[model samples]
Target: MDTSPYLQSRQRLVPAPPRAVFELLADPAMHPVIDGSGTVRAARGGSPDRLRLGAEFGMDMRLGVPYRISNTVVEFEDGRTIAWRHFSGHRWRYELEPVDGGTLVRETWDASRLKHKWALRVLGFTRTTPGNMERTLERLAAQFDGGATPS
Candidate 1:
């Protein structure tokens, strides 16, 4: 189990190049196609075609009730890393590294900067997010691996 109080991450070896993986991550329109949690519905209007540092975008989402959220890209490193945060100050980050045969992708849910870290834990985010991230990565990898459906 992770000892970190405010962050959870999962990694997978994806059989794709860093640029290919980064392209998918940088496009908000593709989020729902790859989302494992099933909360993301679609990208809102006016979002940039490609995300960069300081860019803002909105997503239509639903956990139980439909809602919308806005996010800003807080970190970017071309094909290597990207991270975004919404109003709550937590971030969703992806880092890619070129390995021997493919890219090693790491997805992280970072709540280290949130004010109510304990609240998320109490709400079971800490317990549930890792599995969600793992599935997200699986879906991402599937996009490059002969179109295998991600379960």
Candidate 2:
């Protein structure tokens, strides 16, 4: 219903096709660019194949001054939706849709619990995380040959 205040940001992009875009979303290796934090190394529960409901993994997230968590894939549907809820009390989701010409990737984040309030407050408006997210999307639309396939 009312999912603002807790809402982080959402952006849509038409990049490549659903297959190519889904390939990136299905893998965690290509997340650091969009997530702006972690370098996924050896997914705990499942790795590349963990793109479905209840798929969980421990992402060594280096975020907001060294933040990490083991996240569980809460919601998943091939080429449609992928969501994760962190054990630490926050979550995020991404919705993908194959438009007539290309794929649309929409992303959102929940920061109600304040993942890094102190660090965020200190930064004072120059949030690199969100900036990275936006930049990553733009880059993908600009450079989505659909060859890398998200590790």
Candidate 3:
């Protein structure tokens, strides 16, 4: 487990209604839809279908090759908040809030105490790092703004 503090990103999007934004962010099945990054390979069994608190799912991504992680919903409130923690070791969280035009989404990642050390070394190569997370965030914001890029 990494003890270091996690990094976070808070973004606001306009256009997508609370219901639409909530559905897109809350459900795991929509991963590929808004996640233009091509990350989140597959869910635990297969499809996400729907999401609820305490629910667990599998995710795969390609930094350079491929990496997989399991995640579970830690907390959820309809059209309010949804928090998830990484189950595969790393500590991560995602929080969503309803806004005037759409919804505000925040994502965080923590890998402070990586004993592997090797993983830290690899992260040093920022050039080859994955942009899936960023791309997904942008897409969500755009989709929320009725497919318009927010300023």
Candidate 4:
């Protein structure tokens, strides 16, 4: 985990291989299915189905109000890691580590570059991010383990 105070992370050992997990992470269309916060609605048009470093994707979101986020893939390591950033300047990252016949997935929300970091905290994001991340991992695991789809 990052030592920076502006970063929060959650992890889980999922019964899936790194390649499998990475495929989901690299696909923008799959994001809403694994999102924990329920804010992600769908992948908007013009976004790539599979993302790579420097690729851009748009998502429809609703958090009290409907909105759209255009995100750029800023980091990529094939089956190991991927990260993206939006207009907020914050980043969402996923790291995969092979362990004990499964993959240890670590998701991080880094707001260190945000111009108004305090505003996010004031909005309760700081309080809810960790739990949301945990749920995201659970949803991801279930997607590969036979479970209900996001509705």
Which candidate wins on TM-score? 1
RMSD of 2: 4.7
Report, for every candidate in turn, its global Cα lDDT versus the true structure.
Answer: 0.92, 0.62, 0.59, 0.90
- What is candidate 3's lDDT per residue for 37-119, written digit by digit as tens? 46556555663567778778777666568887777877778766666676535544556666775566665554544456465
lDDT of 1 by residue, 18-132 (tens): 9999999999999998898889999999999999999999999998999999999999999999999988999999999999878999998999888788999998888888889
Candidate 4 TM-score versus the reference? 0.93
Which scores higher on lDDT, 1 or 3?
1
Q: List the residue pairs that clash in candidate 4.
A: none
Question: Which ranking of candidates, highest TM-score first?
Answer: 1, 4, 2, 3
Pairs that clash in candidate 2: none
The 10 consecutive residues of candidate 3 with the worst lDDT sum are 1-10
lDDT of 4: 0.90
C-alpha lDDT of residue 45 in model 1: 100
Tens digits of per-residue lDDT for model 2, 57-126: 6666543554456777888777788888888656777778788768877776665676665654475422
- Show model 2 residue runs off by greater than 4 Å: 1-5, 37-48, 63-67, 113-129, 142-151
Q: If scored against the real structure, what TM-score would every candidate get?
A: 0.95, 0.68, 0.68, 0.93
lDDT tens per residue, model 4, 52-137:
99999999999999999999999999999999998779999999999996899999999988889899889988878887888999
Give the Cα error of residue 27 in candidate 4, in Å.
Answer: 0.7
lDDT of 2: 0.62
Better of 1 and 4 by lDDT: 1
* Clashes found in each candidate (C-alpha, N, C closer than 3 A): 0, 0, 7, 0
Candidate 4's C-alpha runs over 4 A off are: 1-5, 149-151
